[model samples]
Target: MVMRTLAASLLSIGVIVTSMQVSAANEPIQPIKPVKPENAELVELGKMLFFDPRLSKSGFISCNSCHNLSMGGTDNIKTSIGHKWQQGPINAPTVLNASMNLAQFWDGRAKDLKEQAGGPIANPGEMASTHDMAVKVIKSIPQYQAQFDKAFGSKEVDIDRVTTAIAAFEETLVTPDSRFDKWLEGDKDALTKEELEGYKLFKSSGCTKCHNGPVVGGNSFEKMGVYKPYKTDNPAVGRMEVTGKEDDRFVFKVPTLRNVELTYPYFHDGGAASLEEAVEIMGKLQVNREFNKEEIANIVAFLKTLTGKQPDFKLPILPPSNNSTPKPQPFE
Candidate 1:
């Protein structure tokens, strides 16, 4: 993804994505850059919390349930079915590169990933449980209590530290290289001619305005109907739900285009089912240009090139132990 468009986000009117002058109807109205942390302990703690499903009301839905490392870090469901089979309105966003986001959630409601991680547990439509109750349940298990002691040096569990550990883990969930990244580093063979042409069109067509940066799009939020209204039978008001402003209505976070192919059911609302259809919709909604069949296909190919091998991050097993003996498996 391009960097400039992501700097300040696209929520503001007339936000430029870059300094370069282009003929696209909309151009760089913002700037962006890739960023990372220099810490260690928090990330370690976050990793533990990420895999511990005990935080959920059902004790079955870890962050991994929605953001698996093997599948672009996003659950494929159009909307995740949570506790008691409750359905959410939007598709799950990939946690693969969520650490880079300026605001969490499709509506930019949470200011950071740390803040976002703690939200669902008590959300009536999501995890639907209180921290006090959740901690009581997990601590009841001897294995969990021991693990918490080792990971956080405590005899008790709490929600704040739980989210801290998960956020730390999320910070490590980044994909740094792909065919596109290789091309950016000056490897001529990294991208195919068709992919290169698609890349050219991607930038020239004004997608870069809201879809650039290291995370590709997570860095900003924008009106979904800038060029055309996104057609829908069940419409969501998006950011306006949080901001309570008329203009913010239907404005959702611009997801990072990274790993676009593996993470399907696109957009904040998951309106267009396939990437091909999603691209076509973007053509009308954001770019105001109609994509020909070949153009759409080429764009899909280029987007596919954005995807790389699945990220390999094995979740650490729970219950840190002091014994030197080898751990036992379920078979034993």
Candidate 2:
């Protein structure tokens, strides 16, 4: 009798283990891996550039101005405040996990972070400084040239090098180890019953069709209003601006939902104010389905579980400006 009981216990344990393995394998979303350390000097240089408002024409706006690290890697506003307090055309996406994106920008115009880094510096609405001027300003700073030598084996600072440093630093801003990742890793208790149910609904409702991957999105371009039109006063033509094709109208790169709870108001236009509203809007516009109150609530709970550990580091202290440093022409 004792032998039979022990055999039965072993069998049950085997079954449970197999079940957990299967459950893990069946999930579409993957956990974000922690960013491995790259060149320390290069990353440090990038960090300084990321924080230095000298990259902007006004000398007051930095990358952190729009993508604030303390506030879930986003500015937490409907639209970003840009040069001369100008409202940006579209809402700013969070910089956290942006390195995982296949392409940068809503239109996917810039091929990678390196390419994207040079854009806002010259964009009239954003940073409003020419790349040539940006380089000249950085070159004027002797300390920056020293740091450049340490990073790139040369003191020669150019726009390409400047963007490369910024991109290198941006790549380090990844968030990992969320509660959902714990659940995905086979810790069955990581999520509440409602949250788990919500995950099921999220998959069944076709949210995972676009939002599948380590970052839980940013994998492909999708039309925003598949089932119906997404009404917005914002005049972004989406990927049509990039491809210049009428068929690509309303198409945009799906944004990451990794830290959705904190990165609101939601959407390219910042139309939806709350997660509940966002979920409902997504369902109706993307999937042509109307989720009830309970469904929206549970889905939101699951989304909250995706808020992972954010990047932690001391703010970089920038080099002091000297007489050679180019003056910021904010008014002119």
Q: Which candidate number maximizes TM-score?
A: 2
Question: 1-332, model 1: which lDDT tens digit per residue?
Answer: 45555644553443453333232223232222233545555565567667766666666677777776768888887888777677887889898777878799888899988799888776756666667765665556676666567666775667777776677668777776677766665456777888878877888999888887766687777988797677775567888989999989888888888888878888766666899899888998889999998888888888887775455645577664335322222121
Query: How much does candidate 1 score in TM-score?
Result: 0.81
TM-score of 2: 0.95
lDDT of 2 by residue, 173-276 (tens): 88888999988887788999999889999999999999989999998999999999999999999999999999999899999999999899999988888999
Over 4 Å off, model 2: 1-15, 21-23
RMSD of each: 9.8, 2.5
Cα deviation of 285, candidate 2, in Å: 1.0
Itemize residue pairs with steric clashes in candidate 2. Answer: none
> For all candidates, what are the clash counts?
16, 0
